[model samples]
Target chain A: MHLMDTEPLTKLDPSYSTVMRIEGVLALIPLLIAGIALYVAAEVPAWVPGIALAIAALVLVFYLPMKRYRSRGYHISDDRLRVVKGVMFHADTVVPFSRVQHLDVEQNPLERMFGIARLILHTAGTHNASVTLPGLAHDNAITMREAIRAHVKRESL
Target chain B: MHEWLRVNPLSMAVQMLRTLGSAIVPAAFVIFGAGTQDSEKFAEIAPWIIPVLVVIIGVNLLGAWLGWVRLRYRVGEADVRVEQGILSRQARSVPYERIQDVSLEQKLIPRLLGLVEVKFETGAGGKEELKLSYVSEAEGEKLRETVRALVEGETAAPAVAAAGEAGEPAAEPTGETLFAMDTRRLFVFGLFNFSLVVFAVLIGALQQFEFLLPFDLWDYLADLFRQDTIAQAGDALAGYTLVAQIAAIAYAVVAVVVVGMASGVVRTFVQDWQFRLDRTAKGFRRRRGLLTRTDVVMPVHRVQALVLKTGIIRRRFGWYGLSFISLAQDAGSANHDVAPFAKMEEIAPIAREAGFTLPGESADWHRASADYYFDRAVLQALVPGAAAMAAIVLGYTLVGLLLAALAGVLVVGEYFLWRFVRHALDPQQVMSRVGWLAPRWQIANRVKLHSVEIAQGPLARRRGYCTLRFGLAGGRLSFRGLSLDDARAMRAAVLDSIAAVDFAHLPR
Candidate 1:
């Protein structure tokens, strides 16, 4: 059976867009301050700050979130879990259940506010030991963690 | 099992001395600078120095005493627990099964005191899992044996414990000498591992203090080169300043190289003096080092993979070094070097004694497809070549041309190196051999592989090729530029081997 051709992998929660937007605004705050400071210090035309603000909004609020969201996906096979991410630089990581050392479910304040969480899988080797799939729904994270733990137990046995 | 035991109280003195030793360098520098000012200034500082030293010693001793009082450890049947930290009260419990290596170390003071420091290395890579410092040598050995027995018991069937209780003859400790390095071999190792960077740095540091020297060596050299001095020496080279300068520089370079080689020799001797690898029924016991002796016990199953490494110089002499990729990061360091330098013929036998075998011995070796040259070309050549062109367009013409030339040279080098990149699969082992400059061959047991990944980048996907990677317990290795079909087949074969091994390990 073709592995990649099977059922489509699950995507992150839709509310992740709102979370990204909030993150974008928070990130853009410093850039916005820097732009205003430069315009005031250098005494450039008023339109330069306006243009900078427009480009920042286009990048942080719209383009980046959409592309990043589109690129992120994860799937679970019988023995392994695969997380595929990155747009220009694509990475597909497949970790077997037997290799998993532990599983962690985390929800930062921002993620908790958005009703979403992240699932992290720690494996044996140092390189690529921690595979994280973020923007998972809170319930989905719990269930997936349980499923993975059970899979590891069965595999080891 | 929960009862906490503290190390010998004398450990506090060792801890305090260690703390003071670390601070002594800075304190000495301060005193030295003060002494250079004037006798009055030195005396002014000297009076306060004693009190300051006393206070520092007192504080360190107090801290060590408090730390010793707070720190406690216990060995449970299944796990080892440590409770430390005077203020925060930190506790850690490491499972016996996860203990990959148990190492015993003895420094000069500790050895004189007949005490040993035992370190437990669990595969987890944060801080060290646990350390029992300044325990009696006998106590340390007992703790090591108990942990090893517990870990072995977990694997070989709990019946091993019952057999022990029934006095089924305590496990035989007939350890064989797998390998040992004598003074001659160590000297050869030192000669081959000669490095000049340390000497160069030292010379540079000395040059920084040239102003502080009582008499200028350069001035002495200039005086020797004076016309009167030359004439007194029979006027053989009265006006040959060019020759004299060249000779002086050449002598300096030779001096540096000689010093560098001597330093390398000293370092190698100190590190690997009387290095020995012993194979006990429990696992491999390695003991080495001249000044600070280290003894480590690495269970056979804990070794993830075996790596045969040879440098360009060592390759000419047919000498290769061997090390194990173990679950513990400590085992990956220089201390785990099983063979400092061994002949090509010696590798297979030595590796066989370990869990894995040397590549091409029991397997049908298949050289990676010629397309691998293209993969290396893209990585080592095309990308850099493109960067060169970009640099040229961006007005860095000279740098771009140099980079372009370097890219060309590497591509040709990798073209020659490509033939060495071969992979083979036996019934139970997977081996990959690669490299030409410092030819390295890695053999990993199929059963130890945690995951197999087949990755195809954008370029490889278009080229119908992929890179296959095998992730073992401590490290991972990959073979690039396999056709998609071959990659898939290898992945399936590896997965099948893993399954078969897992099934074999299952209870009948």
Candidate 2:
């Protein structure tokens, strides 16, 4: 089987990593509080919060979001849409336009502020039934959704 | 009917009965416990218990009543709409074209009341898309007919309906009988599908609830083998070391097999009593039951693939089970069994009827390389071997050794089984055959192909191989350890077929 590799993948909006980093930091807030409480109670060493901050700064602020953003990509062709993501375990799914049951573009508060939205593609099978591509420019998400909807309608005929 | 309708008033009674049935056991247990403790104390609490029971039943009945009152459904021109939920109203509209199946179920009470539960199945698995419980039988049938008509109209064009692919005049031939099983076949099928798991569960339940049983079953079983007999056997085996251990294991094996086969036969017979399949106007219809009859209609076009399975013992008898990987959800069942157990010859006609040929014993089957075989063997053994080593280090020497031995056996067994795991692609179909204990042949029509995927992990990339996965409407098939080039080619072929969706074989 020779797969045609002419189509190049379009990378997600660069600001996606910034959104991921901000979300990650928000998640680490509780951990930071716990570390501070332990130190204030004189139970944990002063280095505890220091270590926590360093680890959070390294992972949440840098490594994870950057690595994830770099790994995520998608390609939309005339007949199908391909989404590739996964840092450790890579998955490249190609959903044929005819098979798409529905498509949706959603924006959470954070994503709305970031000017990005998520595009979801629902297919027939239970396994990998829906593929979500996050961190697309809001306008791009709408365009992609419309393009997919139009393709689905034409192919369904 | 254009107007929105509620289920029959009998539904409230049905719901109440269901609630009562579940509450009966717990209520009885409480009363029994109190009585057993002290008759005088039980008498004092008995009066209070009556009111408590009444309140419990009242609350359940009220909930059911509210649910029934709130739930309303309408049969639209091309869609079925439902408005339900008391507190948070939910409205669902399902297009007739998306309805994969229509099943009519009847329990004793509902059947007696001339009521049926109609369930609409969409390919998406989880809950039934629509359920109308305790609807009048006639109304249920009418609704089913309407949905089925819409599905047929969408698929069957004027020209195609004139003469079906089978060359049958498509005026609906009074429902052609496809397969039916007799009592003898049912008994044999039960025997072949013998489940040791059920026997184990039975023994486990007996052990756990030994006190609950009226008679002391354990004591009775012990009485079957006298103390003297056991002592005598032990003495006789003392001369040969480990002989008694082997004898005990052999005895247990024989007992389990005997019980397993008996229970298996009973289970199969009860489940599939009077099993029958017939080709209906819109699709294949199946009706069977011992206690609660189920009528499941699987629309032809909705079937994603066909699966043929045969256990080691069943294979010896040249018998195989047939099931459809369809969008149709069979209420409580996973795979809708078309034929429980049939000889290869018997299954061929049914296969052809479904627009496919039976898996031939001799075929041009393609297999992965020897490296692929070795790769599986290594992967299967690696984790277990490592676990065994860790266990040995943690002072579980004997168990660790046993685990290591089991892992070795598995790797060797897999090496042999790998030879049978192969796939073949014909013009119209792609077949994947796999298994050691139970060989399963999954065949998908090219037209049903929904999508194609190629995944390569770091390990697979290093090995110069990748996995090719093909998606159908309700199922996914994966071919592992294929060379990168072959995986790409297969993916391309599958995608091409999906793009070139054949209109001639559209689901009808």
Candidate 3:
């Protein structure tokens, strides 16, 4: 393989990281269980390992999302949509609008609260049939959906 | 075939029998449970048994009758509609344009009864479609032809949508014998397909009929293999003469080999008897099986890729099984096996007919980055090496040494395995060759690919290498650990090929 990097991608809304942090908080429930188990079953004060887990959870809840948010982006070109995401495993996907079989715009309560939505394009292909771009302003997601639908309709004609 | 109609009334009987068939296991369980309990339990349930049996039969009969009465269908000019429901009266319609295929299936009972299940497959999901079962074979064929004619008229997709080649090849005359396997060829193929499925069937049989056996089979086997029993057996074996022990061991080995080979041959003969693949107007038609026969048709353009693979032992004789990766998924496998077992030379022609070219000696092949292999080697060795160290420290010196040796071998073998993984891209297609002893090749037309992805892990991102994955409708083709630049270039090339085509005009 060869080596070159050229990208023209649009970054997602920064607030999406806050949603990830909220999700990361779920990880602490397990830690809480472990702490109870340690107190009931053990004789040693568990502060040493407890601090390590707390620091790791803090990174997961705060620092990691901050870094990951920078890596998530999408680019909609003339006839295709490109989604580039992941910090550890960077995946750059390109899906032609013409191949799309259906489109969906969805929002959860958290996303609604943040005034953002995710636009999903479902293609007929079994692998990666659905390509989703989240963290778009709700209106922006709606606008993108219409743009893609029109492009696909014109192509079919 | 066009009018709104009810299915054969025989379906009600078949449905009731099917319900009764499913009830057998639970009924047996309850009977056994009662028999094994206190003496009074059997006498207590005896009075209610006849009434319970009557209630069960009544319910099954009522359900089957209701289902047969409620189900109705009409294959209209523009769409196929199915109306079913005892109370709500639900009606659903699928446009002729959206109906991708009309297929027929017949399980053992249905086939014996001269009935076939007609299915209308749409593009959305597997078998999430209207089914008309227990129809006469003749009616089923007529229904399939009607749907096929309607679909073909609008899309002109009945013709060859050969991959890798430019434009369409004019539809050839049907019933051309493309490939076949006679009994002798099948025997050789069966030799390499050795399996121990008889043991699975035996266990299932044993579980179902445990009370009929003179001894508890599970308990007897567990006692035979118990720790103390094995120790005693080992001691008894140690007293035997070397020659006698060698002959006993050899006999056991021979017995296992005979059983495996016999079972494999039985399975192959039952599944592939009189196997014949023909080029038909609808697509490639495959007719096979001795008992539960299957006849499947896979359209040409719907074939996304070609997979040529072989077993470790078969590879020595240059035999490969060629299958078309298409939307026509057999019960479990996505591949439509054209030649389940054939030499490379024989498989070439079949590949050619599908518009795919087998890579020649001159075709370039490039492996993943050396750094990638090196990183994997270290990672692979780390676990075993660490385990060996911990084991040795805990005093299991012999096992530790073996694990240490395994780690050493893995470090060197990783590089050797990397040599077998490579891909070559050409003007029209990309072919990936992977695996070690049983090498497999996956080839797909660049134009047929729907999407392209380039992925890089943290280590790969640092090392400037990536994995490239292509989205084929029902097939998989991916290359791991290519130089990032090459990965991006390949993705762009594939995307360009996909962009050049009008997807609307692409065949289903």
Candidate 4:
């Protein structure tokens, strides 16, 4: 199946900028070491490591946009909850409402700062599998959670 | 209380000898070095050192005497009480219901002295229930019978009395065969344990090297084997002719078999020396040992799952070890551990005797379709394996870059194939089978499952697949390779089964 065709319509909330900053801060130590070594070592060829560090920094800079593009809004159909996620490798996962074993709503410090949340939907599988929707507006995440829970209960009966 | 029932009084002498052997080595070294270097210094300290050594030896002798005096045990109604320890004074009581299993042991020394030690396996939470250090063979048997009767009487009386009072027909307790092992079978079973050969070879090699500091002629023999000169001479002889080659091979095989036989004899004597298992109304009773005897009783209902394990070689011989996983009396540390219940050629009959229906034996087993998704997931899992393979190959072949690259590719390919073959799961009623070479099988009831989870990663989402994990009360089970729809379906099926189980009707 073509992945792009099944991509979810909903975009990640703009609050993912806070997540990008947290990731950047965590990445700062190695970035600083690379920058200092590049500046101080005149006898050594600096351009190689300098270019590598620059590429990594650039990747981190686009983290929020990439996450926003990949996060999918979920919808409950008659028998299943359809999830669409992924940007470069756009994909869809459809978990039947009756099969949902449990649901979790998590808020990390970065997400909490921006009033954003992550919704995890769990099913019974060998490896504990969950579909995480990151950078969702808190209210929307809660609403989506309740809707999934209600749908599961109704279908299970 | 009877004189014949007592252990040999000479057991104390053996203990004293052991204590002296332990103390003499260090003391001798200290005295020898000090005495040779400084006569005056040694003379000044000899009086103090000798008295201290005498006191230590005296204390050991006294301790052995007290152990003989205070080590009294009695099989009472509903429990076994053991009074032991000389200085602090200690008593242990184990209720009949709490006793998990019993073991009988006979150490070489004790056997030579015609004494046996009886040990009781209580529930996981307590220290070993009881240990009867020195008892005659016949007395030990009588004690085992009396305890078995008391346990059965205590549990049976309550049920019968209640039935009588209610004017209901008493349920007939079925007579079950408890222990079954012939000497020929034990010999076959012992022979098949290859671990004994490996252990013996390892011990022999270690002894031959003098790596552990030999104290006597044993060390001299070890040095001879370890000498490079001897090894060179042997190698020269080995290269000379076909006869030498044949002799070397024969010698190696004989060495291994001799070690294996020694190990087998020791294991058989210790584990099944005077093995006895009795069936009572409450549960099965097992007793075995040569020197240190042990007795264990396990109620039939408490047995949660029975497992039969066979290795590649053992499978050829049609031999397997039978073990059980039972509910944890305590929810803490001892969770999900297997207790060996029995070993027999066919586990089904033993399981039936233990009051449980064994799953049907079907070689035509189908992998849960979810296994395919889990299998495909291995490609993604190979990332780490590939990285490790790359590092090792690169690290070793830095001098020859082309060779390193070729090795790296081969390693990665091997890992990919191994991972692909190892990633399937089969869910069963009592147990789930997983793993590859050293297979791990886990078993529990659906009613014991506490939670379930379904998860999907970015790659898995692309494939429309998710994993389903069933978290039981004590442990967990997982199914991979399921489409989202299938995962959900499996989850509902598991939950429904869990809800339908009426635990109250299960034998308790």
Candidate 5:
């Protein structure tokens, strides 16, 4: 069993890893609070269980972001865009340019600081109607959106 | 021809009633609260009731009238446009070329008033379609025809409203009906559609109006459960011969079955009375429902896929349901059930009309990877198996044993599901068969797919298998648990078909 696709896909921007780690730290704050609350609530409990759990979470908070960053990649061909993402639950998606109904290049404050953006392609399908490719260079995201937009045929859905 | 018109005047009264209905709940709360908390206030308000009622009625009528005056629709040469709203007005137009179909609906009150609602279905899912309510039935039919004619491109003459039930397709009255269900067939279908929903409704009604009953239902049940009743009944049963007891049990079972059958028959009669499907110049025109009659048309060319489904009980009786996965999502369902109950032979012609062939001799279907399903079965049963182990650790032997048995059954059932599943793909179409107890088959045109997705979970990655899913506008088609190479190959094949299509030239 091979982990990688036969043709290697281009990896996401390196700074996206930092953004993912920031998100991981944000997720940990609530869990850390819950762990401390449980440690206080439990009668006659040693601090060892909570410490072990915290250590495990701390490891994951640092380790999982890099794993996810490594797993995600995207390839743009002549008429289609294939995006591969996720480490635990991997999904490889391909959207044809002509099928795109609309396009958007969005940037959150965090992404803006990192000089990155997400490109969203809207299609007419009920499920999977929006295919998003995040973690692109800000300028690159705009370029891709314009390129896809040019190929998009505006027809009544 | 452009005709700007307002809806039937009778609709104003219906609108008023609807407005009043929404206000009734709050009004009831206020009135009842006043009566309970302060009798003096209620009495003080009593004398003014008639005047207040009159004012409310006047206001409601004025609003309805205003709405009616403001709402206007125009049938233009190229599109149908509707302008509405009082202060913040909006004008919506649907081009004739974009309309996938037109459906006419009539609820009980509107039917009594001889008015119907016309719906223009587009390629987008059901949510944002166009609707025109409370028009004369004849007007609705004419509008449908004009749209149809315009969509097909103007011909020599304008379409004339044909003579049939609600201006049916121009097909001759003597023309062979593609499919129809008479009372007898409906009865057979009812027998297969066995349900106990009526019991649930009955229980709900009992709960809602329990005040009418002389005694509390809980107290009655408690009384019946008392020792005396059980002992007396046991003694009485002990005196009866074996044959008599068996006969009594049989009668009880028969009674329960009759109740289930009655409910199924009643629902079938209400929902599908006089069901008819006909191939018209427009497409497949389906008409059904007793109280709320609906008329919907799906263009043959617009059908993206075909679905055939059946329950285990119905399948045993050689009954299969046929559906069309068109752009118009029918209510909550993606596939429109064209023939809800039919035999395999009967469904062939309908499938042919939708451009699909059911799996049989000459058709080749490949089995899914054994490791994919086997690993899936093991993974699915792990949760329950671990739960059983925990239960045993807690010293609950009975619970643990039961959980173990359940886990075993799950493994066996999932394995059977995987064994029954098969998939077939060719240059023209892709098809898959899934489910063991109640089999469902979906056939989708390769060119109609909007996008492709290949997914792999941790277990699948280790096992060298992937799941391939296709994005359809109003349906689902997927091949799960394929080897990576096979998945990539299929993706390439489908992508080739999609890339070759010049979507601008295709009809909307």
Candidate 6:
């Protein structure tokens, strides 16, 4: 498959950092559940703690991907938008600029602390089409939103 | 408040009596059954229980009366407001712009009582948007006409006058209009197959009572076959009895035909006594039913596809029922249910009026995509049916010969059904035809398409084929039996169409 070229168009910084917090919280629940299960099982071997520590260490390793996700960026071009993110599997999804239905800049408590935001772009599809570009300065997110909205209007018509 | 428009005060009392009467039959049965099981226990409590039951009925009637008193509605310049609820105190206001459809219904008693129920459908979730249950038949018609006019962008001045007349302390529209079904068509529609009626009766019996009564029709038929006297007579006069039996069977068939026609006439009048379908600017308005009336309004644009069905019997008479699959907006309303509305061939004309072309009649229909005609029937339908039969046979540890025979028949039946899965895809449209005995063709425009999926299972992978399913806002279109390459090509074409076309520019 031929990959589309990525050209810098505009950047978005969504308002909310709660999404990142939600991700962290979701990851913690499963780890906690596993730890509780191990503790309750009477037949667990002596070396189980070591195994649990290894699993926790592996989970901690996932912090890198989460950080990369938090730092992931997106740019819209004249024809398409590119979302760049990866820990191992470097990926880019090219959404045609015409498909963009609406754009939303969201901010939550965590993003408020960092004075950053996230921008969400919605497209018309059965599954909600959205690209969340996080970790951007609030001012930059607003400017990027206006620039993209204008480009969408000009090019789509 | 207008003084002339009023619901009957006695209507509420009648409603309460009906509810009590329905409950009494089952309640009496339960009490009697329990008493029979424990006569001594019943004897101890009978005297006190009897008075308690009577008091309960009286209290129910009082509550119903209060409920009727508390319920009232008002019509404003741009909206309809209803105030209901005896204890919680709730009110609803539905604006004219948001109104999708309006329905009017009148029960047998209500019809005789000169009262009708009005329902307003909005694009909100499940059916409870707004309802006025006890308006006079004239008021109901006036309200329906007013709402219909408002939605269709007609002058609102007449509506204001109608509302004034309704609120006035005077009776109006004493001329009752009764809509009747064509008797010949009604018999044709009902007599072909009693499956639906039988199914409905069975469900009603099951839900209303747990045990099937010995007097049940199916039980009676079973007893007739089980009688030893009939079996002996059959054995004694084999040839002569056979001729007599054939003559008896013919007579029975004629009787059944007559009974079926009678049942049809009764059903037609009961279900569609005041049946009406009105065209409005927004969409179609439908209302029918006697005791528990229903009203539904479906917006024109919201309709995804139209399906026309005809059973073998109906087909012989050139009559078919038309139903549209639409996005559900109300829970308690008929529009939200899985079953579609039953209307005669007249639906096609209405659909054309509402800006939709009947499927087969469309000049835009091109040859279906090449994938629809492939030999995947064995994989898609036959294998699954056979596997199911196999599982059942093995689970029961049935004899191998018997299992083989059953599985063979199932596989054959599946293949026959699968033969009907034909489809066609175009740049701007997609059409599919399915069903064996009652074939149905669906055509949906690409502009209305919501999503597309390309699926390949394990077997599909080996066969180098896949299925492409097109999802519309209101329904779905699935075309199986395509080569993987062809499926991918179709998907790309659809995506390109979506990207290039402006849906708003499409012809409405």
Model 5 pairs whose backbones collide = none
On residues B171-211, what C-alpha lDDT tens digit does candidate 5 reach at each position? 32333468888999899999877888888999998887554
Candidate 2 residue lDDT tens string, A72-134: 999888877888887766677777777777788999998999999999987665566677989
The list of candidate 1 runs beyond 4 A from truth reads A1-75, A104-119, A134-144, A154-157, B1-101, B126-128, B150-159, B162-174, B200-254, B361-408, B454-468, B480-486, B498-508
List ranges where model 4 is wrong by over 4 Å. Answer: A1-157, B1-50, B58-175, B196-232, B235-239, B275-284, B329-346, B353-356, B361-364, B368-444, B453-469, B472-490, B501-507
- Could you give the candidate ranking by lDDT, starting with the highest? 5, 3, 2, 1, 6, 4
Candidate 1 structure quality by residue, lDDT tens digits, B200-228:
77789767655554456678768888846
Q: Give Cα-based local distance difference scores for all models.
A: 0.77, 0.78, 0.80, 0.58, 0.81, 0.59
- Encode model 2's per-residue lDDT on B1-508: one tens digit a residue: 6888898888988888888988887568667766886799888887798788889988988899999999999988878898889899999888876776677988877887889999888655567467888799988887777676565566545634554565754234558788988999988888876677885787898887566554668788787676577778767777656876798779989988888888888888767889998987667888876757788877676677888988887788798888888764444444488887888877778778788886575756877655677888888899889999999999999989998998899888878776778888777888898887778899998767766777778777678777778776556688887777766666677777776663323555
Q: Could you tell me every candidate's TM-score relative to the true structure?
A: 0.77, 0.78, 0.83, 0.55, 0.82, 0.64
Candidate 3 stretches with Cα past 4 Å from truth are: A1-4, A13-62, A108-115, A137-143, A154-157, B16-69, B84-90, B157-174, B208-236, B328-330, B386-400
lDDT of candidate 6 over A16-93, digit per residue (tens): 334454555667677767766777784576467557765665555455545555545665554445566544333334
* Candidate 2 chain B, poorest ten consecutive residues by summed lDDT: B326-335
lDDT of 4: 0.58
- DockQ for model 4 equals 0.06
**Candidate 2 vs candidate 5, lDDT winner:** 5
Compare the candidates by lDDT and give the number of the best one. Answer: 5
* Cα lDDT of model 4 by residue, B1-508, tens digit: 2122334466686667767877887677667767876799999998899689889899999989987786666676657877778777788888886654454556666667666666665545445446776676666666665665455455556655654565632332334555556667666656665345567667787666433232455667778888877899878876779987888789989987877876776677556655555565556655565555545455666655554565656555555556554543332332221222244434556566655454433522224344343444455445645565566676844444554455456555445433532222124343445544434444445544434556666666666766566643223556554556655655555555544433333445
lDDT of 5 at B188: 90
* lDDT of residue B443 for candidate 5: 89
User: Which 10-residue window of candidate 4 chain B scores lowest in summed lDDT?
Assistant: B332-341
- Residue range B245-315, candidate 6, lDDT tens digits: 78877987887667666676676555554565655434565665656576665656666666666676555
Cα displacement (angstroms), candidate 5, residue B231, comes to: 6.9
- Model 1 residue A85 CA deviation (Å) reads 2.6
CAPRI accuracy category, model 3: acceptable
lDDT of 1: 0.77
| Candidate 5 segments exceeding 4 Å error | A1-5, A25-61, B1-3, B12-70, B77-79, B83-98, B123-128, B151-176, B211-242, B379-408
